[model samples]
Target: MCCNENFEERNKGEKITTTLDLTEISGMNFFDPHVHMTSRTTDDYQAMADAGIVALIEPAFWLGQPRTGIDSFIDYYSSLIGWERFRSSQFGIKHYCTIGLNSREANNEKLAEQVMEILPSFIFKEGVVGIGEIGFDDQTAAEEKYYRLQLELAKEAGLPVQIHTPHRDKKKGTQRSMDIAIEHGLDPKMIIVDHNNEETVKEVLDRGFWAAFTIYPFTKMGNERMVEVVKQYGPERIMINSAADWGISDPLAIPKTAVLMKRSGISLADIELVTYRNAISAFAQSGQIDEHDFIKIKDIDQSQKFASNSILRGGQQPRIDKNSIIIS
Candidate 1:
């Protein structure tokens, strides 16, 4: 049977039920442009590697609750460039990150001031790709204050920007996000407007900013809708990401969406562009990414440790079974 074939068995005079298996699209390289790896596990890393994910970017985001101090932000940003980078590399995935004060957290006026003070120090770090996952959460004046500051920060650092559009009044927020970026004299081509939908995609693309869709299970963009988006947009500056985090989400959303795109008759080159290339081109403005280096799979030494932390525990050895049905 072909790998992409639906898994089903026929019964006399009965309808057959089938399940979509993601493994069908195995070996296709993917790069999740926006995900929260700090909220993921080692098993998630292994599954991503198995699905042929070559690289990913974990944007600094709210930690589900408000952090109390500027020192907390410092530690969190340190982990993104330190521990998280090492963890992803152990699974043969090159990890990159974007640092900024998330919009929700920006509402805290007291802490927001301190965060802005500390952001400049981290924004220029080695693994830092851009200033992002930044923009309006509730469209508050404080959020806008920090948002514009980070836009200036990106300009000073000569890095790209990632804008997080608001969930409520999305169309208005999406437009405002672009308007603000342009107002700051930042070029649209150097910005990535994320969490976009059908209503916002056209305007974002028309304005020349990259539009990134997050394919979540019950909310945001679904895989079926993504196929149609590709059909409508034709893949120029369009990209998809799992955006999986501590919430209810799937880490394999990129590869799974790629499978759905193929089943829907999207061409391989277009699939490659939206699922992988577009993200690289958008973020490579930081001059931190070299497509050739990241596209190649690095050697995985699961036994390797960073800061006294390894992917293994209890002296467990690494397992490499791609087809084994056994669950340990």
Candidate 2:
């Protein structure tokens, strides 16, 4: 029997289950390489912690619309370091962030320029592991300009970079993103060329850059395709992410994909490498990812306020166990 089936049978009794819930991954931990927890709810945080999400890396991304000012960028960066970090810790998850001028918003040359000046300040701050989710969106000149700038910031900080490849013209854009990072003298091993698919994975791996696949619901790669990439490429410098944000995304994408891979005959070591080990290795380059912080839950006071802002609509309890398996 496969690992998922074996674990499930041993834990849940010998019955074929059809759900894609967290019960399948009871004892395993996951590291979500990309997610926008700023837009997510406390319920999401509670669910993630319950699902064994020991750590996550949140990248500064473009909201559905463009941000207007530098103070907005400042506040956003502060939230990543301050509020978000505190919020995640309340549930026993280590929160890390990547600061950069994202590709879509890079089109606003004036605002992007101002944001660039402030990026260096935040990139080295605590909880920031890299300068990232920063690359081409439309493969435009402006996007390339800021992408190179952020690569320099990452290089200066001695940190790794998490690149966001263009959704359109992805192959050329992915290649160009890597080429520029190399041109800026950033080591290929220090860069993660994310959102890679079949067309781009070979070049990414061959160039010594890490290839990250986003296993989303309807766009980017799905779990089945991700499994194939791992099978063909053999999972050395490859990783998977949820990139779960303000859209239809799954925070459990990594663990769920790991479960699928196990059921499909991928080895446990291979599953662990892509879903967990690879991310920790890359993020550790920041010198801020503390293994001890992730090792144990800091004493969570269930009585304290959940977020500096409110986690409830009215005055709901902060400690709701969403995963209670009740069979009434």
Q: Look at candidate 1 and tell me the lDDT of residue 96.
A: 94
Which pairs clash inside model 2? none
Clashes found in each candidate (C-alpha, N, C closer than 3 A): 0, 0
Q: What is the lDDT of residue 251 in candidate 2?
A: 84
Q: Could you give candidate 1's per-residue lDDT for residues 1-328 as a string of tens digits?
A: 0012233532235665674477767768899999999999988998888787889999999988889998999999999999888888767788999999999999998999999999988888887899989999789999999999999999888999988888889999999999988999999989999999999999999999999999986668898999999998899999999889987788899999999899999999999999999999999989988766664436334333455766543233375674598867
TM-score against truth, every candidate:
0.87, 0.86
**By lDDT, who's the top model here?**
1
- Give the whole-model CA lDDT for all candidates, comma-separated: 0.87, 0.83
Please report, as a residue range, the 10-residue window in candidate 1 with the lowest summed lDDT: 1-10
What is the total number of backbone clashes in candidate 2?
0
